[model samples]
Target: MSEQLVEALRGAVGDGHVLTDPDVVEAYAVDWSRRFRGPVLAVVRPADTAEVAAVVSACVTAGVPVLAQGGNTGLVGGSVPGADSAPTVILSTRRLTRLDPVAELAGQVTAGAGVVLADLHRHVRAAGWEYGVDLAARESATVGGTVGTNAGGIRVCCHGMTRAQVVGVEAVLPDGSVISHLGGLPKDNTGYDLTGLLVGSEGTLGVVTAARLRLVRPATGSAVALVGVCDAADALDLVRSSVPRGVRLLAAEIMDAGMLRHVCDVASVPWPLPQQHDHVLLLETESPADGDVAMDLPDDRDVVVALDAADKARFWSYRERAAEATAVLGVPHRFDVSVPMGSWDAFVSDMRARLRGIDEVEEVLVFGHLADGNLHVEVLGPEPEDERADVVVLAAVADHSGSISAEHGVGRAKAAYLALTRSPAEIATMRAIKAALDPHGLFNPGALLPSGPASPSRSS
Candidate 1:
């Protein structure tokens, strides 16, 4: 059966595009965080929407689970196969790199799923526009992957999430039917928005082939400032008080002293501020004039602002290099969650004390977009397979009335804990939608939705 499925995939997408070698397929089987991995019969690369539909159709007929992967940069296990013994094939969308011309008047562009985020940024910037979303993995993160996760980055407070920027999408349904609506309409009173449904579905409902994305005008001039704060509350207050009245706040990020020190040591760069503080708040705003933007800020606290492009980039490195630094230490159990503003400080304090009690926890690093309550928690020393730390962290989030996931979707990593954030009825509704779109349960099974008993015919 595996041989026949491989032959069918080779027929749908060309023979050369199908990879069966263990060495080659291994890379596609693992995820970005290196925590989840599973076996696959073959890896199929589809170049266009037609090929993707054909690949899905073939897999559906053969009763083989199809996992649609774009760049394979997902931190959760959604983009990769699971540990189940069910026969699976990974459909790679790296070759679907079709980028259309930017529509200057409409402020939009259509990009294939395989187009990298960084490349799309450059493409629009050349046209005097910018995409709202920005991430540290921009160079490798693909359009489809970001859409699948509905990624929110530093600019989310200003431009909103990936769902806000996505005007339309082209996707292949579970049964291999293709649905496309890339018109980029400003207001479409369409019924049951399939584009919105697929934006953050985590590939369970369908495979996102391309997206018509909304673009924003580029800022004329920007200034970045790094301010030292005693804690999260002080940082929040400073953000409200500081910055000129007319200037628009572009981004507000926060990092703890421990996380900063680790980033500096790993990146081998000096701390931007003169003295160390418990936490640092990085703010970027549109500059009203040419002179230093930091000068306008009250001189009551330690503040370092950068107007020069090079200095600004250097200052941003401490926050941007955080994930890279954590990866260097080893594979850490990563959690991207959101807590309420009022309970933010208390939640962090509670988590710090709880996680430290665990013997295996070597270090806990916390940082995220301060304007929003999203926090990226990285814990070292727990084995990749260990879920003890996960329980402690996610439980704390639930106790604080916070969500289990913020930007990263509830892939296999957090699927089991979906109940902590979502109600039983909500989960049931989601399951019904999954069943309707994928009755056979062949598209990305065991992701986003929790696992249940396998059916007689299909093993999810």
Candidate 2:
């Protein structure tokens, strides 16, 4: 049956695109974090939406599960197959690379699922516009994967998440029916919003083949400032004050001295400030070139202004290389959480105190998008210490009415912890949705919601 499934996939896509070699398929079996892996029947590379539908149809006929993967750069275990589940086939969208003309769509651009996020940004930028969402993994992250996770990044403070930019989508449902709505309409109240549903389904319901993304005009003028603050509250206050009424804030990122110093050392970039402070804030303000916007940040010695594009990129590079720097230092239990804006400071304080108290915890580094109340915490230590710290961090986030997983979706790794943020009723509703869409669970199998008879779990 497995061999027949492979033969069917090859017929659907192409003989050359169907890879059954363990050496080649192994790379597609794991995720970016190397956290989850599973046995795959074969890796099928589909060139377009029709091919994806054909491949999914073949899996449906064979009673086999199908896992959809894009760039395979998801931090959570969403893109990887379930290790404990029956062998499933991976549908790689790398060959579905097509970027529609910007003029045709006016304020939007339709891109295939295989198009890289960074590449889309560049294509749009050439037309005097931008994709709006900016992530450190843009170069490797695909449009479909980002849309699947509803990704939020550094520019989310101003532009919002991938959901906000996804005006339309093209997907193949579990039954192999293609749902196409790749039209950027300002108002479309025709029926249920399947496009929105597919945006963050994480491949459980269907495969996202392409997307029509909303674009925004480039800021005529922009300024970036690095400021040292007393604490998270101080940094929040500055973020509020720095943005004038007319000016648009591109981003407001906060990083601790430990994280900043580590990134600087790894990137070999000079510290912009003379003395390292406990909290570092990267604030940016932009407006039309003809419009005048005042930058009224607190006057301090640590505040360094980036006068040009190169300087601004240099300052932003420090924040962009944070994850790589931490990885270089060592593997650590990592978390991406968001709390109420009011409890941001308290949550950070509580988490720091709790993590530091753990004997196994060697170091706790923090940084994130301050404007949106999302924080990325990295706890470095042995498995014993890091695992304990994970508990403490999740508890703290919940206590502050925060989400255990913020921008990053609740993939299989975070499935059990969904209770920390969602109530039992909410979880049940999610499960019901999953069952309604993919009744046989032929899609991702185990992911998102908690594992049960209704919905199984992906192997850790």
On TM-score, the candidate that comes out on top is 1
TM-scores for all predictions: 0.96, 0.94
Which 10 residues in a row give candidate 2 its minimum summed lDDT? 451-460
Over 4 Å off in model 2, which ranges? 287-294, 384-387, 453-460
lDDT per residue as tens, model 2, 36-105: 7888999999998999999999999999989889889887788888678788889888888999989545
User: For candidate 2, what is the TM-score?
Assistant: 0.94
Q: What is the per-residue lDDT of model 1 for residues 1-460, given as tens digits with 9 covering 90 to 100?
A: 7788888888888899999999998999888888889878889999999999999988998999988888887888888888873757888889999999999899999999999999999999999999999998898999999999999998998899999999999999998899999988899997998898999999899999999999999877788889999888988888888766767889989999989999999988988798889999998887655444732567778888785888888989999999889988999999999999857789999998999888999999899988889999999998988888998899899888888899999999988888878877888899999999999998888999888632111111
lDDT of every predicted structure (CA atoms): 0.88, 0.84
Question: Distance (Å) between predicted and true CA of 84, model 2?
Answer: 2.5
Q: How many residue pairs clash in each candidate at the backbone level?
A: 0, 0
On lDDT, the leading prediction is: 1
Q: lDDT score of model 1? A: 0.88
Write out the backbone clash pairs for model 2: none
Per-model RMSD to reference = 3.6, 3.2
